[model samples]
Target chain A: MGLLSKKDAKLITDPLADNNPVTIQVLGICSALAITAELEASIVMAIAVLFVLALGNVVISLMRNIIPSKIRIIVQLIVVATLVIIVDLVLKAFAYELSKTLSVFVGLIITNCIIMGRFEAFALANTPGKAFLDGIGNAAGYGLILVIVGFFRELLGSGTLLGMQVLGDPIEKTGVYAFGYENNGFMLLAPMALITLGIIIWVQRSRNEALIEDH
Target chain B: MEKRTDKNSYTIIFATVMVIIVGSMLAFLATYLKPQIDENKRLEKQQNILYALGINDNDEKSVVFISTKDVAEKFDKYIVKQIIIQGDKVTEDDNAYLLDLKKEHAQAKDKGHQRRLPLFIGEKDGEKFYIIPMLGKGLWDAVWGYVALDKNLVVEGIFFDHKGETPGLGANINQRFFMDDFKGEHILDGTTFKGITVAKGNADPKNERKEDFKVDAIAGATITGDGLTAMIKKDLRMYMPYLQTLNK
Candidate 1:
């Protein structure tokens, strides 16, 4: 009952909606722009970040009591970096092609502000159980936005999802559709990712008045 | 207990222990995963080589696509000879497969140094082709490729890859449209080596000399294109002695 308590449930579900990390907190926007051009890369990035965030939160929370306040940031960084390196190594071993496609972004997860932000803002003050839930909640929030943006970007820019042809490629197959749908090349660029985020933010804020900032 | 936890000495001790643990974990993971990583790299290299030799079947009607399982067998079937050439001398070294072209090129650039260049000789449908591996610096990072030339020194096929390049601009070097343009371009001009030029959208098809040596560069990726051209010329020049001997 303690594990499934209403408060514990709120800690997990809050970030997925009203307290969304990307839309509300506006954390981890850099990776969202860089890797969302393709759905597969975006998904991999999300999973990598999720793994780092969850483990980092748990590790930090477990050590929060003994950690000297003066060196807390350094401790958090070490944990996050170690987790990132482990994720990078696992990806290289199990999913080499995707790992290559990800390249430095997986390594760059150490620099992602969301992981550090959680350690400082939540994990440091919370119990390990609550911190773990918060970590997962924030990661899901970030991952949801990434997958949504990636879905649109891949669908429009490449006429594919996860490299599978969803729409008939006009360049490859002519007369497959009544009206040829040329891929929107602009959608592949970084600017489109920003636009996609803006749209998500807009829809999210409209749906939940709580997300709007008070003037 | 509270006083002990806040002390500088305590922090140092905790930090030291944490670092040791983290360091060993990373070292262990890297060592354990090295084999799989190396295998993936080997298979990827084989696939790239087979692709450059134009043996990688993409036709859906035939076999759908060349899977990872098929790359090793296909590579062995097509690549009949592995020759190492160093300044007019050819050595039959199966270790050519293991040669790091980038490292060899760097050593060659040093004073009073000789580099052994690996050349893969492939036979497809009774016609033989020479495959030369190339390495170069792109705008951001390393760019590498394989060039396969027919007996006449005309480009048969090419496969380009990059470590880190601007996507949609420089990274398009790997695309079929860019590699396809190299086909039929002559790598030699009347016994003199004239490496393929990646012209900046100004390649003149009407001019016989330009047509023979030049291919259209990727628009908006001039640096990568230039790097590719320079890489092709520099690497191919090293193997010119072998090529010339074959001509004789």
Candidate 2:
């Protein structure tokens, strides 16, 4: 806490609540829908996004002064791609087992709207340190929603959490299955992810009325 | 006055410079890491092959391969022979396992190029496992696996993996539940090599009826299941002529 002043600290804290990337800005919904079918996937995606977003923001911020505005978007895209590939290559070399898990997310990370969103919105105008914090905050906030959705989806859909049969084996008809509680096949689908995300947005807006717009 | 960065020539130069820097950096890193990455992949291939032979460190629920540090020794101990069948010119090759299937597939497509098929024959407790490697297309990207069979052509064990299948859905192909179900399933329907099918709604969730040549498909993974099914059929059928000799 002492390492950051209040202004810099807000760069980290604000996105977790007020400027929440997924819920408020509604960015990165693609990945939130795609990977949140399981808690493990959501967690993996969260970590992947966090790593990319933070490092990418710092890189973009450092280059902001010299970057030509005409092709800034392309530059951002290239940067993201380079960073993701470099990380993947390093992981494959040093941590072979972990690389297998992370490699699957490489394409997902490079294409994430959140990384681009943060680069254009915050990094282009901010210092490297502030952009890094903002990246961490936004990614965390996004991950928080993904984890929530993933929890409900995996719990209800598969009757499991992180592949653990917490509700007992569905096939064996033990534990919760004994209570005649059936798993909802719909929860595993993308529509359910959208609906779950909508519910979170609704709840978040209710908690903070400022998040809602009078249309 | 236009800023230095805002000029047309500046934008082009910036683009060119960025590309060169990023490109060289990436190319250099890839080159530097090639050895280690290739080593990891080699180790992984051994682990996957051994896994299909049922020589692993798996538990009640997980698909844990033998540790990398000890895998080379264990692979040598279990796998008695490595054979390559190139259009009936079958021969023993210690390094046959290293043959890149992707390259072989590409070459085989060329005129007069016979696909070199690598097979590992593993021996444990006086039992033999004829392990075959396969590659197929999943919904998102390439899906591949290794399947081991006994003399009767019944699947002994299997290991499935993918490049970019959907997590928790299609990617569950590598999970224990899906891979374990293939065990004891026959690849042949009475002298005819009929590869096993991942049938959905076949009323066989338990996979007890191995003779039916069907395994219950993973829920929400229709494409990956089909890919695995096709991979087994396509790749295994190629080796039938050579495999059929085992029974004789």
Candidate 3:
């Protein structure tokens, strides 16, 4: 309870649902659409974002007082960029193939609205502990959407899950649709990702009427 | 403290310090990780070379996929010679592996200079294969690959890769389905250097000669396909001087 009071726990949990970065805030949609084609890529991207966000939040929060208000945005950017570079380097060193697959998206994490938005809105005002939790929570929310989208995309688009052929042989290989199931090529495109996100928003808003915006 | 935090001078000083700290931190990380990154790149390059040669665990019948650890060892064992060719002459001065194709191509294009091209000679099961490195511009960024040729200058196999091509379209060049089309395509037609062409659709029907000089291009990736075609033709043409010597 001391480590995470009820208020602190909300900082971590609220973003997972109500204040979700991808669904509610509509932040980090670019990467969410781009890397969610495959489950493996989505998971790698999620972890990378999680690492950058949490560390960036804590670093910026610690320096909040010392950072001049006029140049605060620049300071936040520097911190985020540094963390992103570190993540990029570590990924290149250890997970070379996945890093290559993710390509420029990882480096572009510095520009992701969610990280910058949090630095401005939460980390600058909050304590380091709260900022850290908020960062993790928001990134988890983003990751949840990515994984869900990736699951459907990989399964429907390629008849595979995480590169494993769960739906027997591909139509091309089998020369006929296996089990009368054909890959939905539409799911592989970016527009389909937007549609998937819209569906998610619809489901969330319907389940929780508070999420619906009043006209 | 409040006065200092509000002052422009303090902001400048803070920014300078932060930049220095971040710069040094990045520099330190880059330097520390260089060896490991380089090792990974080396292994990947080896794997690509092996893949281009169509010598994998499946061919060797050991494993379904060749592990990264085994790539370097396999490369060393299979790749028998490293040849550097410059304008009809085999140069022993430069190491083939060290020849950066991108840089060399840039220098050649910008300054009208000629540079040595690297040709890797690989041997497997009593057959000799010639592997040529290719570099060209894609729609968005650089695309590159290795093409392995048999004794008659016919494509034995290929391994294409891109830097920043569009996903599901141009980036599909990395897929085996695309690269496999290059196999058995002739780069040289009886001393006539007619590099392979990535035809619009299924080249099998349109190709009158049936000489394996044309392969089908990916739909909706016309630019990338054109880039690949141009890359292969241009790069392979540069090797003609060396390839001519091989015929002699």
Candidate 4:
């Protein structure tokens, strides 16, 4: 309360659950489906988006007054692309192995609609400070869902959490495999991610009746 | 009421200026960091080649390469000779590892040009190994690897990497289980070059039959596995003429 007013703090707290980017707004679903097959990749991508979105929101907000309305989308895109390239280059030079793991995601990050969505919807009219808070909140919200989906996908599909075998080895017949429990191979596929996300959306809405809509 | 940013003239000028600034900044950073990036890639190549030749820090599961600070010295200590073979012409070149396989593979289609195959020979514990680099297409991007074989042309060990395969599926080609299965597999059946296949219906799942010319495929990675199989067959076949002369 000392640092931010109630309204300002809500900007940060709102997206964690009720206004979540993934479940509520339904943005950035492509990446959630693509990389959530493993818990580790999901965490890495979430961090990458956190860095890009927070900084991008600030940059766009600072230039909000001067940016031409006609070319605003292009301007927003350039900011995202430039930041991603810088991140990619730095990682390549220093953290080579980590960079290789993130190579596929560099392109994915550029096209993520969440970044564009915030830039156009919030940053275009907000102050840099508020925009930064909004970015963190939304990115955190998106990351929260990604981790949940990834946790189940990796655990059920591969019987492992972050590459560590939790369930028994299927080949060696140890742990749960001794009990005739098999990993669900379908959970690893992209379609399964959609179903998982759907389940999350349903659970989230049912708990908070405000999120439900009557047609 | 029309605003300043809404004007077409201002929009065009803003775009032009933004493009120039972003373009130059990127160009400068890319150029400035090229040396470090290239050095990292160079060390990775040495580590991968050494890993195939069985010089690594791996335990039972994870694939760990030698530290970058020590890779150069270890590379020099283990690799005794580097050579390039083209058609019938063979030449010893210390920098043969720097040769771009993608370019060489492309040039192979030209009228009279032959692809230059770079192979590294390493000696450890008084045993000689022939290490060959292979390049191929993965499900998403380029898949490349190093294969080390003994004088009898039996696979000693292998390493696989990719530019951008699917994270948990196709990307597991680099994982230990998949790469480890490739060990002891034969690239030759009798006197013929019968390269190994990444078989989904592998009869001997434990890979106990080394002479069967097969390794178990990752469950959801059919295309990547097939690409790897074709790569081994295509790339290793070109080096057969030189490899066959080894026993003689």
Candidate 5:
């Protein structure tokens, strides 16, 4: 898990590509859709989720034996939420404007299936270090899809990336580029996130024909 | 053999400890940051009001010139009075301009206690501006906005936002064309009360005397448009008697 061994390296790096969460496992798609409208906001949200999910997994794994079997889920939830409150407070302190922009998406990270999925699937049985790496890799997988979706959505939706003007205005305003800077503003909306994510799934599956052909 | 604790004892201890730790931590955090959060919300409200008034305070250099105190003073001096009306009676709330509606909503239900409505009156140059709060139903939830008027009671500007409305359609109230269409439309004429109307196409081309204040509903968002129209008409109609005081 420290990158000292082959099996540990495989567990850590594989989720980045072949065993990707969004592309392969298809976990955590809800936040991926809700926050991927802006590249800046999506990146911020991704980092926050990565921190919470990984830390929650590590802490829960560390406490695995001591936690009563009957109330394990509740314990995990409490730890995750405490971490979330800290993150929420930090954001309100340092990034008040962005915090407002992100709204409830930050708090919703607790409900994100990726964190709980890892708690149930990886954290309970796995070593603390391995559980942490697994959490990081899975979070990276979620972040990858979000960044891709956000890249396209922000570019097309606003004719800008990270709020900077990339595509020039239509000829009427004296700039170039024919795709038109006018907001197909719908792309900025949440439904567009679903459509783009669906497309990503389609393309990924088509390339890996064995997934479809296996049945 | 290790002494095994009773299951009931562990359960009670765990719940109690977790509750105390989590609850105290939250209490501590809230106590520390509540003031900063309150200040941010206050500044944000001031900015919203400034935007509605069409005051350009964007330049970084101007940030030094425009502080919350400046905005508050300007708002206080020019936006002179706040009136609360229920049925035919009108009473004044001195701090109505500063009153937070989010706080106002939490008061004990007084079926008999009157709802204190705040009207912001700001003057620029010599013209009086009436800033009225507009609230109504949107497609999915409650929509609220501010409609500002000049001394003549013609529309000045509007700033609308909603809880959950379709982004491209109903949410277009945030756009200028919709809000600007409200500018220059008079809500009253002397003693006769002519409530503002929201029309389709173009409002039956106004006369020279009444050229500026006309609102046309956004074409496709008929339900939202109708709702907004009804909202403005209803809220302004309530403030009609209070507004008549400005003419004197």
Candidate 6:
């Protein structure tokens, strides 16, 4: 039998929707709630995750045969750590200010269950190319939710998109459209991100019939 | 051909080597960056001092002008030294204010009050200026700022910095709009110190000081604003003796 087919592709692709990493699978919720407050930071985080997930999956799948059964998990961990270090160095050098804003969140990528879970469950069992694609697909699914959540939070909360003022009405001089709220409901807080993510999950899962029954 | 290999020893040896290698690398990096980091900090402080004094000259001129030798050589011509006092008595010495309060605060672990009472005296175009340092507690962390005054001890410019205050609210203290409001505000009357004060919104910045300097506080960050006022008054009071000396 061929390793991957149309049916297999459908299975892999469907998880992006029916079994979303953040909304449905309920995995990798920590970063989803933290970095989603700002669109720029959230987008950077999404790209970082995409790189780690896809690369980790491919490497683990490739070494699956040669890796000893007893030390496979350890080997996987080393590869992920190496990749994370490289990412950290690059971030520090190129994106100094953004890196400061992200702080420890970038380093926490190593412990993200989504990366580890995908490596063990899907990557180890599948061919390298398929594993890589699955990783990208799953990461894309996660990124979609994060971007959506981040977009609304930053826009409504800060009254700006990407730190640029989209709202022209001034409250200082004329007092028209004066909400008197300076920072769009404290964009610094984490609870709002959780609430937004919960709403997204509810909306997404409510549309899927298989998940509707709550088995 | 089979051989007996001590796997335990091999693992121990590898672990030891890895630890040593990583530790030495981190130590080397720290050592390399130490001088540059210190230089960055020194240059930043020098700039802040010059900025606080409202002197915008070249870096070399700034260092030469601020050096102890130059200060002494041009003593009566430009720079004037002051002693700090509290309640009509010298609390410490004039040199106490010269020490960096940030470094002292870190070493003290928030245990002691390392108040800055030093006032910088500088001259430009035959006009004298007084540069004062103010330190206070903000909503989340420590806040420190500088106020520059003319020979008359009238406020000319101000700069405020906070550690971790909310950006838009508390951090607005760094904006020129806020600082520009301080210009021409007086802190002394003849030889008596009136001290800096916080004013209400729409209040006149030039209101005669009976007890305060009439500096306006940020609306949302009232606590921080009040904290700033208290810091300014307290720090200014410490320099009364020196101010009196300058007046004479």
The candidate scoring highest on DockQ is: 2
Rank ordering of all candidates by DockQ, starting from the highest: 2, 4, 3, 1, 5, 6
- Score candidate 6 by lDDT: 0.64
Which runs of model 6 end up more than 4 angstroms from their true locations?
Answer: A1-21, A25-146, A173-188, A209-215, B1-17, B43-100, B106-248
* Docking quality tier of model 3: acceptable
Worst 10 residues of 3 chain A by lDDT: A170-179
lDDT for each residue of candidate 4 in B9-102, tens digit (9 for 90 to 100): 9999999999999999999999999999999999999999999999999998999999999999999999999999988899999999999999
lDDT of 4: 0.94
Query: How high a TM-score does candidate 2 get?
Result: 0.97
lDDT tens digits by residue: candidate 1, B1-248: 55667888988999899889989999999999999989988888888888888877655422122578988888889999999887667798865877997788679779987788899999999999999999999988999999998888888988898987764457668876677778778888888999998887464433245335888776557899999999999888887778777867
lDDT by residue for model 3 (B84-196), tens: 87665676532476578878876776664658788899998899998989989888899999999887788898889888876555777887667766777777778888898
- The residue ranges of model 3 lying beyond 4 angstroms of the native Cα positions read A1-4, A94-98, A172-182, B1-4, B58-73, B110-112, B166-172, B188-194, B197-223
DockQ for all candidate structures vs. native: 0.32, 0.79, 0.43, 0.78, 0.26, 0.09
Native-referenced Cα lDDT, model 3: 0.81
Off by over 4 Å in 2: A1-3
Give the lDDT of residue B184 in candidate 6: 71
Better of 3 and 5 by DockQ: 3
Fraction of true inter-chain Cα contacts (below 8 Å) kept per model? 0.38, 0.78, 0.53, 0.68, 0.12, 0.00
True contacts kept of 3: 0.53
Give the alpha carbon lDDT tens digit for every residue of A132-183 in model 3.
9999998899889999988988788877787667777753446336456677
Q: Interface RMSDs of all predictions?
A: 4.4, 1.0, 3.8, 0.9, 6.4, 7.5
- All candidates: TM-score: 0.83, 0.97, 0.87, 0.98, 0.75, 0.57
What tens digits encode model 5's per-residue C-alpha lDDT throughout A158-201? 66677565777532344545543365667876788899988988
RMSD of each: 4.3, 1.5, 3.7, 1.2, 5.6, 8.8
Best by lDDT: 4
TM-score of chain B of each: 0.89, 0.96, 0.87, 0.99, 0.67, 0.65
Q: Write the per-residue lDDT of candidate 1 for residues A115-213, one digit (tens) a residue.
A: 999999999999998999899989888899999999999888877787667787554464343375567868888889999999999998888787788
Displacement of the residue B211 alpha carbon in candidate 5, Å: 7.7
Judged by TM-score, which candidate is best? 4
lDDT by residue for model 2 over A48-77, one digit each (tens)? 899999999999999999999999999999
